[model samples]
Target: MEQLQVKLGEKAQITTVMQEVFATEVGAVYQCNKRNRLVVDFANAQIVLKVDAFLRLKKAVDSIDLRDMAVNTQRCSDYELLTVCGCEKLYVLTLPEIYSFKELLGGAKFALELNSMLHECLHTQVA
Candidate 1:
């Protein structure tokens, strides 16, 4: 029917438009406002996460103690396991990789916050 065709057309038009937020040698982060999602491409994995989930992921990564990870002799300390509250994927990263991941997430968070501040400033009334 024509209604079905129209629905399909609308769905097609809802394409993801992504903007690069940050990048590093190990990974890159992108934001898609249309979907309100952050796409993190890291270590051969592409993770699509909601904005809140991305924040939680950043918090989790930031909580890791690099010094402890580096100094511990336990076999389990060889790799850090990270899991965000709402995200289903589990990330296992070695010390160096964890450091890179932390940097990537931190940079992305800063870029997104900066963009939000710019938008607010640009749109504010000149009162």
Candidate 2:
């Protein structure tokens, strides 16, 4: 049940996000052609998640074409969340926007392979 809820707080722009979010990861985070979108790279999977809204981005998480993997979705007031398969614990990704999670990152171009890799690395660990 470990989830990272990044509230926009008082901020109103995308550029400011990199400063707050980048602190969590040293070099694994990257910004692309998109403004509010970001990529979290990990050993197992690279996660492409949009930081704008919770709902619209959730849809893109579903539309992401994946092979030989599992996906789960949940509905919340703030956002709709999704979790892809991991080596052990669930790999939880939350979209905290009020709109459909699909709308925010539909135009975003990234690798789903990165998504899976981020899921495995962030959510699982070897014992």
Q: What is the TM-score of each candidate against the true structure?
A: 0.84, 0.23
Output the TM-score of candidate 1.
Answer: 0.84
Task: After superposing candidate 1 on the true structure, give the runs of residues whose Cα lies further than 4 Å from its correct spot.
Answer: 1-15, 125-127
The digit string of per-residue lDDT tens for model 1 on 18-116 reads: 788998999889877656778888888777788999999999998999999889999999998889887767999999999999999999999999999
Weakest ten-residue segment in model 2 by summed lDDT = 18-27
In candidate 2, stretches whose alpha carbon ends up further than 4 angstroms from where it belongs are: 1-27, 53-127
User: In angstroms, how far off is 103's CA in candidate 2?
Assistant: 28
The local lDDT score (0 to 100) that residue 31 gets in candidate 2 is 47
> Best by lDDT, which number?
1
Clashes of each: 0, 25
lDDT of 2 by residue, 1-127 (tens): 1232232334642233332223122224444433454554432344544544322334447654432122433233223334533211133443322122233233232333466587799778752
User: Per-residue lDDT for 35 in model 2?
Assistant: 47
